[model samples]
Target: MDVRFQTGSKRFNYRAAGILIEQDHVLLHKQVDDKYWALPGGRVKLGEQARDTVVREMKEELGYEVHVDHTPWIAENFFHYDGHDYHELGFYCTLISNQSYFQKGPYHGLEGERLIYQWIPINELNEIVVQPEFLTAGLRRVPEHTEHVIVEN
Candidate 1:
């Protein structure tokens, strides 16, 4: 995510993310530059619904078609990084696949040069550095007693 910031000012960059949980694990995209992982969603396109963004992002990033369940709006987060501020929404979704779906590919041809997919325990999230919003927002979508939290905020 390329963000520009003004000196001594915070600018909110609008973005969206998705939380994919299965069993006690959550699906995350591991970026190359860092070991930290993130949920499988991206910034919302103009005129696009947040739900649609999750579905589309899954296809583009993971090459799997997904079904977005329930109305989005679990987490809304604001943070500053890389000299800029961000305002993001995290949505919860389910993966729909005709066959076992794993691996990364069919990437939208940008920002995913070394992306890899993995299912990680939710409780272990704190061991790594991730987008805080994704963790906060993602947890709300899962069952209250779930061992793993899906946070997008």
Candidate 2:
């Protein structure tokens, strides 16, 4: 099972996210009508590799197949949301797509409250809320090798 827990009223999760970039832009998932935006991925299933998790999440969230070159980033995130505390360990991977990937806004994604795909210019990423926050910098100045990050919000 996915790693999760509860402490009093807090909830924690372990997830994997993708960092698909094209033309200096990155794909993001947004909850329509909500002030939240995140990477295009989800929880890593039990016994699933984090890299595979990103691939599976892409298909589930975008209905397209993708390949991962490498897992370039890992995050240990902590935050508070809607009345509960959360701690999420996330894997941020790079995607290599043979098919044309979305490079614009409003691409329909996984079923939810208008959960859609969006491509944000890396330069203008400061305009939205990207969980972990560190991605904001990492994407702009991508490291030569994988980097581990810890985020507490």
TM-score of each: 0.65, 0.91
Q: What are the per-residue Cα lDDT tens digits for candidate 2 across 32-149?
A: 7768778888888889998899898888777778998887788888898879988888888888888878565577765655786788999988887776788877789877688889
TM-score, candidate number 2:
0.91
**How many residue pairs clash (N, CA or C atoms closer than 3 angstroms) in each of the candidate models, in the order given?**
12, 0
> In terms of TM-score, how similar is model 1 to the real structure?
0.65
lDDT of 2: 0.82
Go through the candidates in order and give the C-alpha RMSD of each one to the true structure. 5.8, 1.6
| Model 2 stretches with alpha carbons more than 4 Å out | 110-113
Top candidate when judged by TM-score against the true structure = 2
C-alpha lDDT of residue 136 in model 2 = 74
